[model samples]
Target chain A: MLTGAETEVVLLSFQVAGWSVLVSVVPGILLGWLFARWHNPARALLQGLVMLPLVLPPVVTGYVLLWLLGRSGPLGSAWHSVTGGHIAYTTAACVIAAAIVGFPLMVEGIRLSVLGVDRRLEDVSRSLGRGRGATFLRVTLPLSLPGVVAGAVLSFARALGEFGATIVIAGNIEGQTRTIPVAVYTLLNAPGGEPGVMRLAGVSVAIALVALLVAFWLGARQRRRVSA
Target chain B: MIEMRTRHSVRGFTLDVHFESAGPVLGIFGASGSGKTTLLHCVAGLLKPRDARISVNTRMVCNRPGGTWVPPERRKCALVTQEPLLFPHLSTRGNLAYASGAKDALESDSGWKIVDVLRLKPLLDRNTASLSGGEKQRVALGRALLSKPEMLLLDEPTSSLDAELARDVLSLLLQVKLELKVPMLFVTHKAGELMALADDCVVLESGKVISQGAPVNVLSKPRAIGVANLVGVDNLLRLEVLRHDEAGGVTLLAMGADVALAAPLCASAPGKTVSVGLYADEVMLCLENPAGISARNALACDVTRISEMGHEVLVELKIGLQSLRARLTPSAAHELGLAQGTHVVALIKTSAIHMLG
Candidate 1:
């Protein structure tokens, strides 16, 4: 039922959210396990830094990303010196914005799940002549899969809804970085955009509901595993 | 062979345990919070000690002064804890296969023997999450064995189980120890398990070795205050089986040269010497040779020693050359006017005698 432009916007949103989740998942799992298992004093600092995006204002976070990736900024200058390409106000910048805003949610979900895994199981694995890495892959990772999946889905949903960060860093370029939320905002600004707004809003709600249902299912599975 | 001389202190509880056992299974016996589990963890390489010199099969695992320390996975001691923390995501077969990472090897002699010995073939394809507690433990044991460990470290592996289940698991462990001939470090609070499983034992009391030797020898004496009851044998009577009345369901046992008692029917043949375990509380002391009582055995004895325990008195009785201990309420002792050198009759029920092979 959607027009070609609306379909493109919808596909772009999925692409950006998918990429954002993909970029955050591996690092999120590693960070989550580290936070759950490591007891070093610096762990608190690392945890706080990881959680900063979750508590910080999204607009402020976007502004910081903008400065970091802007043409004159140090990183952006380095990027220009190497690849000779501007990252800010691009589709790549939109993905970065979505990833940054959604990373904390992903990490938090995975961390809690990793924490829920019994350490005795790891000890048993080690005693069975399995090294730390192998034990993690064979036992810890599989056991914490529910949490990992839930975290990824939640992060994808968060990435889909990301607005302020995308607006500031990616600049809502039509047909390029204009995701569902950005498209809705743009349509709202136009004189006769109420119908378009309702359509996109409904789609957004549908995606969020699906993500939430998936997360709930995964969480229930995790609880069953634990009880078992 | 297992050698561990370690000292680790945590929150003011200093654990200083030292022992060396070359026996097939060395039982570490202790109550809760007595550092038994901690000691096992040190041997398993799960806990780093403040200082340690540990060796397994003559190979040095950890030596603080020598600066040689082998990590857990390489320790070659497969630890099976109380709870079978099997990988919930894996099937029983998968868990077994995960240990050695060889499905074909498990189908081979050593691994197949483990599966067969643990009776896990039927449950192999079932998910670990679906197994019963005893079944889970069996799978855990099977998984540990699949690694072909040099030794097995069992930390109260059956403590969480009920008596029947615990016995079942213990019997399986016994089978493993006998069939595989794998040396084991069996840590337990159950006195019966320690006696049945270990050739040698080290009794820990508050992180210190109170006694270390054969379970029979070490447990015979009250190693520490309030330990005899915990040992499950307050009085051990070395009795010679004279005869068995199968029709009557009773066995006549001779203590030393003269003292005799009737015990419940046992499986031992005549003229065989067996150790009989009698709990102190079960031995009743009477002021006179009481008749008309259904109790089967009553022997006249001289009270050799009277030691006061919590709310009760442990009366050490000497009947001829054999010694017996009876726990009497303080009021009974007062009523009977009991003291060292007093003559009294020790009454015991025929079924109360437990034959210890």
Candidate 2:
């Protein structure tokens, strides 16, 4: 039977993307809400920092990651101290590197949505005897969930395509850190390149379309419900 | 009871309003940016005012100098702003239940569920998005009621509605007051709204409560001159000297039409243009120019503009040099078919003209 290497690569891509998206949501929402509600002196600076990975060339971002988590960096050493030098060249590193690149997408989407939310609604909620936390949870958060969903999908797509950063930070290893993009890159550099590239490209396209459709469907449903 | 004495400076506007309300329904009347809603917010514990003192049913919710300020949720004070602002995410029933009093919030026997008191069981599952303005207000009212607030602070609850819708909302408010027996601090500038719902009136101008009393007396008296003007008083004219009557009442005349003015009017020289405001309610509309009538003041006039204001009509009359407004039943307007340049009579007694400084 012919090997289904494309399926394996696509599955690994989804795994990394899923982990990246899931890990970043709580922080993304928190920061988005903060940026929306407050007028801090550092808002511009903080926003710039969030978008840095997006602006930096993915290869540059990847190299920076390699330098920061290459066994001797402060975070790398602490992680190594606990996990016995297993921080880099792992699926976990791929997820983390992809998440860092996707953080800006998550933050900006949720931030714009949060800003668009009607704050008067929250005040009315307070007048209706809802406390601050309860009002945010029941009214504010639900109202902004559509943006969160959109952000999550974009983050997942970006994470799935993260090649340069993932390779530099995690060092592609078969069936572990080698996501679809990295596997395709590796294959294209080898003798039987076209077949692997074509196969992985098809898998990538399918996965991206499915994820986007599902994300938009969920977001639209939630928004329609909110409006309804 | 709804009592507030506060001074809160917000941006450039300074809100300094002090008033007390124990009436089943109380209204704060003011123009736009006149600080009525700020006063309401202070009483609701939504805004903490400097040097403020607030009490609701013997419970002091705020004492600013003493650093005692109950948070809004803890205060059990509900507010309905210009918009009904019913929770869009919730159904009508869900919104009402959202504010229902916790067991800890109740000290007495008033623990109303969504269905029993508001009669909202039928609307429980119905989405609030589709409710009409009046229905949404009713739901908002129900939500506020179910909260078991000691006092309700309503800021222009019906201001968003048309006359018919406003009447419906006001009647519901009256019903809520009657059924719940809870005091309400309602704030609005609409004269009709205040008259419909409020037993006591607190009139504010430039963030100060200049007049506060029973609605009719405060509204009709000379001390409440500014409020009367703000309420669109029809007449504020010059008084001319007329022959003093044998009864020792100085017969001061006003307008091209003769009407006696009560004497010893503040800053009154016989020739002084003493501004006496006459509310439209004080004016009488007659179908004919009768030869003899018990009404002391009668003047033949032509109709200017007949504005249909709800069930009633506001007939503006051009009598000699003055224009007078008369609030008449639509039936009267329909009976006369009063329109532009139609002959009519405005018989306003001297005693009916409320004098002011």
Number of the predicted model whose DockQ against the real structure is largest: 1
For model 2, what is the error of residue A87's alpha carbon versus the real structure, in angstroms, after optimal superposition?
1.5
Q: Residue pairs in steric clash, candidate 2?
A: none
Calculate DockQ per candidate and list them: 0.66, 0.41
Candidate 1 is graded, for docking, as: medium
lDDT of 1 by residue, B155-218 (tens): 9999889868999999998898788898999998877677778999988999989889887767
For model 1, chain A alone compared with the true chain A gives a TM-score of 0.98
Interface RMSD of each: 1.0, 2.3
Q: What lDDT tens digits, residue by residue, belong to model 2 across residues B1-357? A: 767678889988888777777787888877778888888777766677778888888788899877788887778888777787877766666676676453332233453432345455566678888777777877777777767777788988888988688877787777777777878888887765666678899888778887888665565555554665665545555556554454644455555655344433243455655445566877877778777676666678889888886777988887667677888888878887788888877777766765544
